[model samples]
Every structure is written in structure tokens, then in C-alpha cells.
Target chain A: MIVIDSPPLENCLGFLALSSYVMTLAPSISRIVFPKYKKAFLPKILLKNRRLIGVFAFLFAFFHGWLLINKRHIDFSDFRTSWIYCQGIATMIIFTVLAATSNDWSVKALKKNWKQLHRLTYLAMFLLTWHVWDKMSGHWTYVTPISMVAILSTTALYFLRLWYEHRAEN
Target chain B: MKSQRSKKRAISLGALMNFIVAIAVFGVGRVVWQGVGLRLSATGLESSHNLPLSAEAVPSIPASHTLDNQGTWIYTVALSPEGSILVSGGYDGQIKWWDRKTGSLLRTIQGHADAIESLAISANGQILVTGSWDNRIKVWDLKTGNLRRTLRHGDDVKAIALSANGKLVASGGTNNKLQIWSLETGQLLHRLPADTWIQSVAFHPGSQTVAYGSQSGQIQVWQLSQSEKPRLLQTLVGHQGMVGAVAFSPDGQTLASGSADKTIKLWNVDQGQLLKGLAGHIAPIRSVAFSPDGQTLATGSQDTNVNLWNVQTGYILGRLNEHRQAVWTVAFSPDGQELASGSSDATIKLAAVHDLAREAIANSPLAHTVPSERESDSQDL
Candidate 1:
């Protein structure tokens, strides 16, 4: 039987979550910063499937949590003691909340507060990124270029959008 | 109305396509990431080239010597028969001799132009043979720390084995060729072309046969006779990855091979058939050695642990989890009292096997969970 450590698989799942989360932000980018490109096929497709992608991201995050728990053999004692464990547990809680509210019924019930509650995705993404960076503190070479590109490009896009809005106001 | 229905169906199809595209991206991205990481790590280009950067951070394992300052990955380690001197060879292209008791660096012998990948000590403890990525095998007089002679190969030498009599030395490497040479004269006796890269070589205790394990997962046993060329005796095949180490039990009755597949397989030497496979290591098995009494087998793995297994029962006796990186090689002192493990973390750990095993039995709950011999054997088959 083939045996492998759970880290690589966990890292891959994390990357998938990050990638889908980044894609979910594409609609906002197109609408605010690149309205001329809003009608583009890629942007429109990503915009239409934003909710589905968000749900998939949370699903991948949950699986990543399961694998991490199995690998670390973490229990309530570990969750209470270690800061690294606390970071992971907190990240999983955020993802669970986001996934639970990702449906249309929750969107209608929460109404205006739905968008406010879904903003927790940003916090989840930040925690997930921090968790990955902490785990790979010394060994950054194993951190995939795709995750780096996705996270950085999303940040840059948001910053550019803010700069455009500020200049317009001025 | 018909156009509206078609548009809704198209949107559903688009969502399905988007999900498929996302999965494809994730799958392809993961594969590429893993591929690049493996290649970089294999070539020693990973960001953290050494694990546990300082000697102070090393775990408190009960080793007689925790020799540090090698400054690079140690690929192989050997203990002299007298158990007084320990030698380690590594990517630094230097073979270091240490006082086994004091853990002090006795001397540094350097001549190889590249990384030393393998080392073998003669049964008589007179000669030390080292094979290097420089495509050369150099024999040294252990007493005087003098280089006797150097034998050149077509490619980097990956493994070396010295006969019990200390007369014949078998060397194999990336060239896919196995060469048997006289240790005294450095004359090549026989050159056997192999099907794949030979990662490890070992001579039977009786010195009548030599076995080498290859990257293609085949272990070939060659019988050495007086006049004729070495005859291929048996080709044992079972491992799924490169067989990195091959060792014979002290009695020469059983041969154990450790592989990149993460399993150690025991073969009945006479029949050339797999008897049992030990499967505790979570990563590639880089080295394997049997204790002097031949009752315990030690395997060093990329998981950074050295596991000792009961030879007769295939039960895990204990695990030495001191190394912070891949444990490249393991060796038992001539008396079988001390076990030495070399790791990519650039430290050599020399622990008293008996004391370590006793402590593990008394403390570790996992030690009591070893599977039965019958169960392990059936599972292996």
C-alpha cells in the first residue's frame, strides 16, 4: 500500500480554496474597476458562478481541516493549548459559518445583512493564508506559486480599485 | 418563451462547465506544484536546505554522540568494527571521523570532488570505502587516515558494499553498472550491466554472493565463483519504488530491502522469495541494517525516524524520532550495542540500541500495538 504524509494533500486543498475564493472576487473587480471588461466572457462566467465557487471554497476548506485534524491527531486539549491549533480551529469555524450561509434561503432571510455576513470570507481568507504561511515558515519553497499569484493579484486588484475611486472623488 | 427556457438551460450548462474548469485548474495546479517541489527538494534546492538550523534545537535523544558541524546533508554513516570511531560522509565532499564516545571530531578526510553518497567499512575494520557523486570510489586505511586508491566509474557511485573478508568491494551507481573490485589492488574484477540505476549493494555474510537493489525496484543476487564471471542467481521483485537499501541478516539467511515505496521487505535468501514486508514508515525508506545479533532490523526513512523492527515477528520494536529531516542511512556498531543514524539535517546520532529499546517499551504506548507475526505476514503477501 502506498503511504504518504497528509501535508501535501492538505496544501493542495488549501490552494483550491484560495483559488475559488479569488475567483469569487472577480465579479466585484469587473463591476467596479474594469466595467469596460464586465461584458467579457470570463468575467461574466466567474460573476455568475460566484456563490457556487464560494460554496466550493468552503467545502475544500472543510476537507483541508479534516485532513489536518487527522494528521495532527488534534483533540480538545490541543485546540485549547496551541496557538497554531487555535488559528486552524478559528479558520475552520469561519469557513463553516460562510458555508452554512452560502445558500439562497440564507441570502433572502438575511437580506441586506447577507452581504455583511459574507464579508467574513475576507477574514477567512486572511486566516487561511496566515495559517499556511505559519506552517511553511521555514520552508517557503513548498508554497505553490498559484496560491501566491491568486492572493497577490486579488490584493493588487482591490488596491487599484480603491485608488481609482479615491482619484474619482478628488 | 422557448428562447427564455433555452437561455436558462444554457446558464445551467455554463455553471456545470465552470465547476469542471475550476476542478481542472486545481488538479493541474496541484500536480505542477508537487512536481516542482519534489524536483527542488531532491536536488537540495529547497528553501530550508537543512532542518533544525542549530545544534541546540536538536531533540534530546539518548545518543552517545550527537556529532554536528558537517554543514550539509549527510548521506551515509558507518561505525568501525571496534565501535570506537564513527565516520560520516555527505554533500560537503568530506568524510569526517568522530570519537564515538566523546562526540568530538577526530579528523576530516577530503579528496572526493563531489557529494559522498555511500560508505562501507570492512569486516576487519582496517579499510574504509566511500563512493561519491564524483564517480569515484576511494579506499582508505582507517588507522592512518590514508587514501589507498581510487576506482573510477562511468557515473556517480550511489552505493558500495564490502565483503566480510574485506577483499572484494562491490560498487554501483547512476551508470546502471555494478563493478566488483579488489580492495587491495583497486583492480576491477567484474562489471555487470544492470537494467536500472543501482541504489544499494550488499554482500552476503559468507561472501559467496552479492545483491544490489535498483531504482526499478528489482533486487538481483549474483553468485561469485572462483574462475567464471559472476552469475545472476535470483531476481527478486516486489517494491513499487526505488529500492534504496539492501542488507543481509547476520546469518545470511534473510535479506532485507528498504525502498522509496516506504516499505521494507524481507526475503528468504535461499529461495529468493519475499517472506514479509514491514510497513510503518510514512515516507521513503532510505537505509536498512540488521543488528549484530540479527534479531532486530533498523530502517531509516525520509520521515526523519529510525524504526527498529523485530526480525522474527515483523513487529515494530521502537522508533528513534530525533532527526529533523530525512534519515539517509543507519548502521549498527560491530557489537550491535550502538545504532548510528545519519540524516540530511547534518547530524549523526549514535544511540545505544538496547537502552533505547528498553525505554521505548516502558514509555511508548504505541510499542504495545505491534501486529502479530502471522497477521503481518499475511498482509504482506
Candidate 2:
């Protein structure tokens, strides 16, 4: 696999901005991604293709955290940076919990209680998004548009599903 | 005190008899309620769901039944168009065909190296299709019980569907691709964008329109255009879990979908609207279909019950509670007179839906007689 070249640390101001944008957008994107299936074509078996795709998404986010650790240049002891670290840790914990339990074995072993644990994915998305966006105050131009689109599209999908369901029940 | 106890016992016995009579009458009445609803509105509940008590309840009974091969876990069952045969795909990769009447083994077809997960039958009734964990769709010539063709993909085939005319066969797999094939010469037709492994596919009768539901809780309509690629006509999304099964009514006007979300939903294909939510399955609903006359729908669920519903009103007409395990498949006969359900309980049951017109006509003259009531009144006089 090819790794893209790292740009200059001076222009890396955009990196922090992009990181915040990705973080802020995760909750909205996740809202669209995970849900109780109304008409899931595939019955749940071990490593169902849908579950595998979900695993891939989680893997991509894991790589995102590694990139953040390498990019953030913080002083050894800053109170402000401690908040960001806490958020990062919380996001990592949520993602790890989701990724670990997203398997056929876990689903069957946990049974009726599996859904409760799986619901943590949404909360993780919320923490990850807030952590990144709060750090970028001056960089509204680049982060705002992307995050706005992500948030709006997710909300649209949710509401559209709600409207369609309402018409059916009545 | 003895007189009061005797009176209480008498009242309880009367109530119990009424309940028993209700079940007994419906068990017979539903199987043969032929001309009963014809006097009512065409779309019975579209006008109003306030149906008479007679239409609300049905006594459940066993028709001709078939037994399935059991595994540590039995997966699913599929019925043929004619309803003469029953098929069960098991966790052991074994597929067995049974005589719908006698529950005897007709034949067993083989091709999958792993468990056979999904099976579909062509509308023409000549071909039987199976999708397995080994990632292949094997089409079997039902008469010969011989494997005719094997369509291979990269991932495990999860769900399979055959069009109403049986001219087209579609399969969705782990690869997240929905491929439609021409059954005539075994040619590749169109590879549509299915965003996820499709859980179910249904076709509209008069048109080249197809509706598929995704694991992502999305159902979209795709029309085969005059152009090279088919166009996405509409997206119907709402369910929270995986959409497990879909069926088009005989006329193709309505589409029914069952889900892991534990609801069976009816959709209006023309306007792309959700029409009804047939609820009550405790576990995930595995499969759903309309009766041949489109008067009723049968839904199978992991809850181990096969529910027969009045389609227009959503009232559960009958419940088959025989299966000790999950109910996997439900099918209606082409003539609309019978229903069959297959389950993990290792059994398949056939239910008859005969005409009620005969019963009403035969009993009307007897009801017109007033001599019996007059005899009782004369004694009192």
C-alpha cells in the first residue's frame, strides 16, 4: 500500500482543521449508517458482508486516530490539550468496543443484550465529532461546508425514512 | 352455598363453549369463506377496517403437511409455485424436497460445499434455485432433480429471487452487488448498484420494474430503461434492521416486505408509498407473501409461528403454532386455495383456503326455516 507524502508542517494548519471536520461529521454519518433493518436482504450469519463493511469503516476510523496522534504537536502539560486527549480517548474506547463486538460470535453469545452494547457506536461518533471541531476556531471556511453537508444529508435520510414510515402505518 | 357454586360453574362452562365454538367455526369457516367477502367492499379495509366478527378470527388447522430434515439449526424453507412441493435448506448444506401432500421425500439436490442458505423458485415452476455459503447460485431442473447451472460470485450468496415470469433471476451476495441474469440462455443481464448486500428483491408484474431492500434499511426501485443502464426510479426507506424478504402480489400492484426489525410491511408500487404495517411477529420476520387471490398474506418468523393475515385489514386470520422452532418460509398455491409453511421444527404444513360461497348457499335455506323456533314457542304457549 502506498502512503501519501506528508505536506509541510506550516500548511499542516489545515490538517488540524480537517481532523476537526471529520470528528464533527462522524455522528451525522453514523446516524445514516447504522440502524434496525426494515428489509435487510441478508439474514445475519457469521461475518455477514454487511457486518464486514461495517468493520472496514471502523478500521478506517482507527487509521484516522493514528494520523491524529502523529499530527498533534501539543506542549507536555497544557490544560486545554488535556480536554482534547480525553475526547480522543473516549472516541477510541467507543470505536474499540464497537469493532470488537461486531461479530457473529458476539451477537449470538450476547443475544438479546447485543443491541444495547452496539448502540454505543452512536455515542462514540458524537464524542469524536465534538473533540475535533472544538479545537478549530479560526478555520470555519474549509471545515464548515464539509461538516454541514454531512450533517444535513444524514438528517435528510433519517427524516425521509420517518416520513415514508408514517405514510405506511396510517 | 352449593347452589351459588353450581351457578358459577355453569356460567364458566358457557363462556368456554363460546370460545371453543368460535375457534371450531372459524377453523372451518376460513378454509371455506369463499363468497363471504365478495358481498363486502372490493378493497375490504381501504374503505373501512371495521369488518364483522366473522372476518376477524380464523380457527387454525393443519392441512397436508411435510417434514423437513433437521440440523443443529435449520435455516429456511421455500415452496414451489404450484404448492405441490416443499423445499428446506439446512445448516448442514443439505437441500431436501418433499411431497406437499404426504410429507414424503421427493428428492434432494446438491451443489453447495457449505450450508445452503437461500433458495428461490422460478415463477414458471420448472426451475428451483439455491444460494449457498459457498457463494454460488445453483439452478436445478425440478423434474430431474439435477443441477443445471451454477452462477458463481466472489462472496457468499445471501438472498436470491426469481421474477414473476421466471425469465429473470437475481442474486445478492457479500460483494454488495445485485446481478440480474437472463434465464433463457444463461447470460449476464445488468449489474445494478445495490449499496449493500440486498436482503430481498420483488418485481412489478406488467413492467420491468424491480424493488430491492438493503441491509442498510433502504429499499429502492430500479427500472430497466431504454438505455444501456437501468435508472434508479425511487428509494423507499424506513426500517431499522435488515430487510429480509419481499414479494409482489399477483397483480403486481402491491409489494410486501418482511424484516429482521420484526415487521412485515406492504408498499404501493405505483405511487411508491408504504401502505400497511402487518405487525405481531415477536422475533424477526423471515418471509412474507400474498395469497393467490390477494385476499390474505402469510408471514413466517423466527418466533416459530406462521401468521395468516387479511391483507387489506391487517387482521391476523390464522396462526400456525406447530413449529417448535423458527418459521422460515411461507407460500401460497397458484390457484389461491392452499398455504404451506416450512420451519426449523422440521415440519411443513399445508392449509386449504376453499370457497365459503358453497357453505352460505347450502345453509341459507335451513336458516330460513322458522318451524324449530315456533315449536319451542308453542310449548311455552
DockQ values of all predictions: 0.02, 0.01
Error of 1 at A62 (Å): 36
TM-score of chain B of each: 0.81, 0.74
Query: Candidate 2, residues A80-139: lDDT per residue as tens digits?
Result: 334535765566556556555655556778998888987665565455446545533222
What's the CA error at residue A27 for candidate 1, in Å?
Answer: 46
lDDT of 2 by residue, B84-155 (tens): 777778655677888876779888755565556578777767898888755567888876778788776555
TM-scores, one per candidate: 0.58, 0.54
Clashes of each: 0, 20
How good is model 1 by TM-score? 0.58
DockQ of 1: 0.02
First chain of candidate 2, TM-score:
0.55
Report the Cα RMSD per candidate: 13.2, 24.4
